[model samples]
Target: MSTIEKALAKQKTKAPATNDVVTEEKNTESNESVSVNPAPAPTEKFDIFIDNEKLTERGFLHTGGNTTNQQEEFRHIKRKLINNAFGPASKTLNNSNLIMVSSANPNEGKTFVSINLALSIALEQDKTVLLIDADVLRPSIHRELEFENSTGLLDYLCGDTDDVSQIIYSTNLNNLKIMPAGKAHHLTNELLASDRMATLSKELSSRYPDRLVIFDCPPLLGVTETPVLASLVGQAAVVVEESKTKLETIKRATSSLNEDLAIGFVLNKTIKTSKDVYGYYGYGYGRKR
Candidate 1:
């Protein structure tokens, strides 16, 4: 063969090899473009605005309450409950972080204590608080907090919504969260006693070791669900109204609670004079054998 013919043939073969290399690079770029994904959207907040000024005016604890003696009183009260939940006492108790605040009868300030206690705990450096208004029959968390009522615990228990995140709401009060009692239902008491509620309780207690979950429950005397709920929590704070709560009634109410629970009696409305702080006085209770 001639030299020119040999050079042309060699050049033609090299051109095809170069084209094949360019084609392979183009294919790689196309696959990468198809695989690349867009960034995700930010999640919206499920939130509630707690009225701190109203809460403070009503003699409750919160950031707005400032350095009042009432704050000092609750600090003393929550200190023991904190010890029971996260301190040394937590070792011996099942789900010590789960606490229930209830009363012998209605209108005894259980909800007041529940909100204040939640506010008190939310102030902790390392702890968070979720307040669940479990009193479905007569929901008050919304009324007291001055927020419009909405679906929550009942909606979840009724299978209206399966997601727990949908029910729990963040508050403006920093580290404090809440789940309202939700719209009242006919089978409310039955729902509280269901196996699903039990499972939910297990998840709430076990999921967060640094979070304290408080349930503002119905009165023990008239309600059947309180005892079922009492069985779930490790601690109970029974509010007894000063002068109005009869001794025998207190006996009957306390008798219904589970013995294994670490119980505490909160003396409510102890204000003898206008000058007094007139806050709750909590005393520990132990079952008598």
Candidate 2:
């Protein structure tokens, strides 16, 4: 069996019987049947063509086929995040599983890092990943993954839908699921700070404590929603383009975040030189409180 097929078979074997699945009534006017503690259900899975050619052109990890140095870099980066999530370091944090990937400014490669990190984490034997497009103002996770656009975080927060399971999509990767940004809204910032959004965030972390929920948030400097979203996550990674991003910019971006959130810095697009052993790019863990 292929990797995807093997994953599907494993899911089927682990799934509870239909009658044993938990179901709850929708509190809203809509009568949708929502699963209270929806374990990764055996649902129809969609295929995402990682397209190594396209990914390499964009300077992303070529996860579609053969292993590359880029993939190895992310594996190393994810290991630290995973360690921080469940290791002894995580004992003090409440929602260490929720992570937000952001940048100092636009085009700093935060989205690329977010997707790559999610992909890397999904490869874990005992971990599943949920990549959320929290960059609602300019959503890109669905587009980057080449998945069809569907209702997502905003829809759940707007009261248009109460059942979040309806918007969450399972991918052929089995361990990776996606939550698109949903339709754009003028009051995006307000919606993100809503009570429902807070509830949803808590639900996502608590329902699947084993799952790593990664949010592709907007640039920290200019975006209003990013700071709000960052507050909800236990950890945040700020992607800084090597030589291009200014120290002042990084300072300004990081200042908006909560003092308690564990922050990390990822130096992306560094020039590859013969002197270095790891090719290009570097990462550093920021202050963790």
Q: lDDT per prediction?
A: 0.75, 0.74
Off by over 4 Å in 2: 1-59, 62-65, 273-279
In order of appearance, the predictions have TM-scores of 0.80, 0.79
Please report how far candidate 1 places residue 217 from its true position, in Å: 0.4
lDDT of 1 by residue, 52-167 (tens): 55666677765631255566666677878888998888988878989999999998999998988888777675778889998888889888887656769999899998766667
Looking at model 1, report the run of 10 residues with the lowest lDDT sum: 29-38
> After best superposition, candidate 1 residue 141: deviation in angstroms?
0.6
lDDT, model 2, position 202:
82
Query: Which has the greatest TM-score?
Result: 1
Clashing pairs in 2: none
Let me know the TM-score candidate 2 reaches against the reference structure: 0.79
Residue 70 local lDDT, model 1: 65
For candidate 2, write residues 1-289 as lDDT tens digits.
3323344455555444555544444424221222244333244443343444565666655434445667667877888888888888788666888999999899988898998888777666578888999999999988886767677778877878765555676664547778899988889999999887787788777767678899999898877999999878888889999888998878888998888788889988775665333335467877633
